[model samples]
Target chain A: MKAIVNVGLKQGVLDDQGKATHHALDTLGFKEIVKNVRIGKQIIIELNSSNEEEARTEVTKMCEKLLANTVIEDYNIEIVG
Target chain B: MKAIVNVGLKQGVLDDQGKATHHALDTLGFKEIVKNVRIGKQIIIELNSSNEEEARTEVTKMCEKLLANTVIEDYNIEIVG
Candidate 1:
């Protein structure tokens, strides 16, 4: 199975990288890019799970254990066959 | 409208941050995280477009101009009203 984990900075969190990117974007003329600019991480993993439920369980554990920093980031996992 | 831009390393491209993350995952015991590890960026933009097609066009422009590094990343945009 294939799983995609999206880990991103929480709302209201300070994101220096995102700020830099926002500045760059503004300089390039996308001036309407309002308030928040938070960056996130995407992790694509291939696992050998036998089924979707199994894959979900394993991927959830993966996110909770290592794919995400629970304190400052939130993550969503999408399991694809 | 709101649009999400997902930008990620192209297949076969070197991803140093992803490598470091994979190493960290391994050290933390997710040994099953086999093979390639690629990282990507997600840009969620909120716009005042009146419709989906307009949002898509504007967001595509955003992606082409600054949200993605066309040389190394591939992006998908999803527009949500």
Candidate 2:
């Protein structure tokens, strides 16, 4: 199975990179339609586990232990065959 | 509409960050199940336009110009209400 994880800052946290990107977008003529912008991390893991549940559990553990800084970030894991 | 963009390195490109993370995962005891790991960026944009087609077009243009390094990366854009 494969696990795809998206890690993003919490709602109240200041996203410096996102803010910079938004400003750049505005300057590049997207100011009209671009209301806001937020950026995050996308992690893709190829796992030997075939079971979806097993993959999800392992990936979640990985996130808690290594992939994310839980104090300021939130992560969602999606497992696929 | 909202645009969710996932930008990832092209298959042949060497991802240093991903390699570092993979090494960390192995050291943290995920060596058995963790076959491979890759990392990318996820950019979420809130758009003033409600039209899905328009949002996608605009987001795609943004990707082509600023959001992605076309020579080494690939980006996928999904428009949602």
Candidate 3:
């Protein structure tokens, strides 16, 4: 099974990278085109799980334990066969 | 409008970060659980575009020009109202 995780900063959390990117875009003539930008990370994991349920459970645990900083980040997990 | 872009290393490219994470997971007792892991970036842009089509076009250009390294990265863009 394959698990895709999208991890992002929680709402209201300050994102320095995003801010820098936003500024860069504006300087590069994308100011009027873009209002805001936020950046995050995506992790794709291939596992030897038997089913989607097992994959989801294990991947979620992985996120909780190591993949994400839950204190200021939010993650969504999607499992695929 | 909102545009979401997922940028990942091209197939066959060596991803040092992914390899490090994979090794870390194994050392953390997730060896049998995960077979492979790849990491990428997710960029979300909120734009003042009129519709999804316009948003998609501009965001695609952004990805091609500044958001991703075309030589070694592949990017997927999705637009949302």
Once fitted onto the true fold, the runs of candidate 2 whose alpha carbons sit more than 4 angstroms away are: none
Pairs in clash, predicted candidate 3: none
Candidate 2 local Cα displacement, residue B33, angstroms: 0.4
Per-candidate interface DockQ score: 0.53, 0.98, 0.91
lDDT to native, each model: 0.77, 0.95, 0.91
Q: What RMSD value applies to candidate 3?
A: 1.0
Q: Assess candidate 3 and give its TM-score to the true structure.
A: 0.96
lDDT of 2 by residue, A1-81 (tens): 889999999999999999999999999999999988999999999999989988888899999999999999999999987
Ranking by DockQ: 2, 3, 1
lDDT of 3 by residue, A5-79 (tens): 999999999999999999988988889999999999999999988788878888888899899999999999988
- What is the C-alpha lDDT profile of model 1 across B1-81, one tens digit per residue? 677778998777898988987787677766664444667888777665667887787778878887888898899998776
Worst 10 contiguous positions by lDDT, candidate 1 chain B = B29-38
Worst 10 residues of 2 chain B by lDDT: B50-59
Model 1: chain A TM-score against the true structure = 0.89
- lDDT value for candidate 3? 0.91
Candidate 1 error regions (>4 Å): A33-36, B33-35
Q: How far off is residue B79 in model 3, in Å?
A: 0.8
* Tens digit of per-residue lDDT, candidate 2, span B4-80: 99999999899999999999999998999998899999999999998888888899999999999999999999888
Please list all clashing residue pairs in model 2, or write none if there are none: none
